[model samples]
Target: MKKISIILSAFVLLSSFTVLNTVWTNDDPHSQLGFTVTHLGVADVPGTFNDFDAKVTSSKPDFSDGVFELTAKVGSIDTRVEARDNHLKSADFFDAAKYPELNFKSTSLKKAGKNKYKLTGNLSLHGVTRPVTLNLEYRGSVENPMSKKQTAGFKVTGTIKRSDFNLGSGFPEPMISDEVRIEADGEFVK
Candidate 1:
């Protein structure tokens, strides 16, 4: 009886330290995934993927052990210009019909500074997969007045080379910049 009581106490103590992982999904109406590229070495053309989803899973309050995942529909790219948007979706660029989606799954999330983290992940775009590092900023969590649930905000920013992904191979740097800037901001809810 003494041995059985001791075993039960140990199990209860161990279970107290076990943290349940929480999954936070993006609040779609408040999230945006956007990109910018320099055009003709002068003007910057901005675009966005209107249809995308992102989620983070973590067992800790600080999200230090969080795993992030995202998926965006290529066909939903919008640059605010019909002709330009259509061209970007064509064979010369993204070829949305062939590569219908962009995906990202984070491998690591390391704290860099106060509220900042280095997020390294595999970004699959245009049928190519490449490792990319992005800057992640945790904007804190708050209770929503409307939903009354906890919500956390985050912003991710990064730059990728079009040449690395074989995107727009025919367009030279003189006409279209090789570097693309990525930005994503979202509020996630449990």
Candidate 2:
């Protein structure tokens, strides 16, 4: 009888945890995952990944305990300039044929301000994984009339040095900046 009571208690605890968390899938068509980098120290060249997936699960709307994961196909890079995009996919940069995807998984989310959060995560690019922190802004959540589903919006911004990932080697600062700025505007549905 004691064993049965213990088992029931354990099950209840686990079930409560599951009930508290909400899982949300990103709405791809409405999302934008893009980056910008300096070109020849003159102008900024903007680009985006055409294919990617992101999901977030949290116990609260603020996402203080959120678990976020994102995967982007390196080969789907688009800069609007075919030649430049192809070059970016070659050995000079992402080397999409060798390392097909760039990934990120959040380790922690800390509230910073009214709607801002600091998200720490592991970013894997070019076969190397490094710790990165992104500034996340929660835009708010709404109920969709069409599907009657709950949806949330967020914007994320971060920077990464290409050299840390062993990408775009030998490009001097005068030719290309090592720093890349990443941005994401995403909407997720529950």
Candidate 3:
């Protein structure tokens, strides 16, 4: 009976931490939301979107939320290589002409620490939706510089196989790695 009571207590304690939601908005005066991946694992490349949006729910405001949804326009793909970027926009990869957008929506979140979390979500790319897990690090919350609204900071990361989305169809044979690392650093509204 004592062991049963102790087990129940532990379960309740864990559940308390699971009840949280944190949401963020993309409104940086400096830049918009975007992502980039290396070509053949070569260098640090960067890109930005003119418009994108993300939301999250977590037990704490400082970390990922219990729910998360991120959406970006496919036409916004920019690697500073115009021809390549255009290629990415074509049917070979995102099929932006048909798909128009890429998105991710979280189904579950679990705390890894006071400022860390494991976020599981479905990533829809090139029309294929797959489960992905992101190692998220909460950087704390602050007042927005312009609006003075409460905002949270986070850096999330995950990797996905491009082939799974039919994105590497025309590569010249092992030209680009099948795996692409996705890193997201953004601020969320509380």
Candidate 4:
């Protein structure tokens, strides 16, 4: 009976730890992953990856211990201009046929200020993986009236050099600026 009691106690403790973590998934239609790059050192062109998903897991109510993961389909790149979008997916750019996904998995989340955090993660794109840091703003959480679920909002912004990832290597800096600014606004539901 003593052995049974000890086993039960250990199981309860492990279960409680599991209960502390809440997993949140993207509210797909309400989320967007977009980017912008300067063209000809004069004009800024913006684009988006329409097919993407994000998952966040946290053990704290304030999300101070959040772990975020995201995956985006490279073929979903859209810049409004079909020709430009196609070119970006070809071998000259993302090479979507060879590397079909862009992925990010956070390694750390540090509080920078009230409702703001510095998120560092490994981003894999176009067959290259690199560590990147992004500014994360926690827009707070709310109870969704329609779904009756807890929803959390977040906006992440950052900039990465395309050359580091070997993206658009053939394009000169004058024609297509190497810097790419990334922004992702997402609503996640628990």
TM-score of each: 0.93, 0.90, 0.77, 0.93
Q: Which segments of model 2 are wrong by more than 4 Å?
A: 1-19
- Tens-place lDDT digits, model 4, residues 1-190: 9999999999998987775788999998999999999999999999999999899999888999999999999999999999999999999999999999999999999999999999999999999999999999999999999999999999999999999999998997989989999999999999
Query: Quick one: RMSD of model 2?
Result: 2.8
Give per-residue lDDT, candidate 4, residue 107: 99
Residue-wise C-alpha lDDT for candidate 1, range 74-125, written one tens digit per residue: 9999999999989999999999999999999999999999989999999999
Off-target runs (Cα >4 Å) in candidate 4 are 1-19
Displacement of residue 132 (Cα, Å) in model 1 is 0.2
**How well is each residue in 103-177 modelled by candidate 2, as lDDT tens digits?**
999998888999999999999999999999999999999997877988899999999999999988967686888
Worst 10 residues of 2 by lDDT: 13-22
